[model samples]
Target: MDSSKIINIIIALFLPPLAVFMARGWGQDCIIDIILTIIVFFPGMLYALYIVLKD
Candidate 1:
């Protein structure tokens, strides 16, 4: 509902890794996201949302 949340969702929708990347940093997590996205569609999306929204 807030601007930060909205921005995070938008970022996640566009590029899932970016959400986690922003939350944590540009590192192993981004690699994990890419692997998840490759293995299962939307898993990375949900993961990103969880990380961003959980905070």
Candidate 2:
């Protein structure tokens, strides 16, 4: 993985929504990440990692 991806993954483990925002910007994916974070933290982290890795 690239350094940026590693950094994003690290961020995702901490602030999932922010990581998603960094990866996808202010859009649906970010919104979903925020919502998932609000609902549950781990799922949000997983989702953020998925978003970061998917691209």
Candidate 3:
């Protein structure tokens, strides 16, 4: 994977919302990530990684 993808994955592991924001900005995906983080951490991480990888 690219360096940026690696960075995003690392960030997603630690802070899912931040990773989503980095990948998608302050858009719907980021908002959803934040909400998922608030509800549960693992789901947020998965969602963030999905967004990062999907892009």
Candidate 4:
């Protein structure tokens, strides 16, 4: 993957909201990211990646 994606993955793994907070541009996106993380649990990194790439 690209460096930007890698960085976002790291942030997502260490701090899920940090990646979403940096990648998205709206409050609703952040809320969605949080919800995805909570719902998926261990797969939160993948969810964050989806959120970042979707943007």
Misplaced by over 4 Å in model 3 are: none
Instruction: Using lDDT as the measure, name the better of candidate 2 and candidate 3.
Output: 2
- Please give, for residues 1-55, the per-residue lDDT of candidate 2 as tens digits: 8899999989999999999999989999999989999999989999999999998
lDDT of 2 at 18: 93
Whole-model alpha-carbon lDDT for candidate 2: 0.94
Q: How far does residue 52 in candidate 1 sit from its true spot (Å)?
A: 0.4
- List where candidate 4 sits over 4 angstroms from the true fold: 1-4
- Per-residue lDDT over 1-55 for candidate 4, one digit per residue giving the tens place of the 0 to 100 score: 7898888878877777679888885588778777777887556667777787776
Question: Per-candidate RMSD vs. true structure?
Answer: 1.7, 0.7, 0.7, 2.5
Question: What is the C-alpha lDDT profile of model 1 across 1-55, one tens digit per residue?
Answer: 7898889889988789888888878888778887887888599988888878887
Per-structure clash totals for the candidates: 0, 0, 0, 0
The lowest-lDDT stretch of 10 consecutive residues in candidate 2 is: 1-10
Candidate 4 — which pairs collide? none
TM-score of each: 0.75, 0.93, 0.93, 0.61
| Ranking of candidates on lDDT, top first | 2, 3, 1, 4
Q: Candidate 3 — number of clashing residue pairs? A: 0
List candidate 1 stretches off by more than 4 Å.
none
How well is each residue in 1-55 modelled by candidate 3, as lDDT tens digits? 8999999999999999999998889999999999999999999999998999999
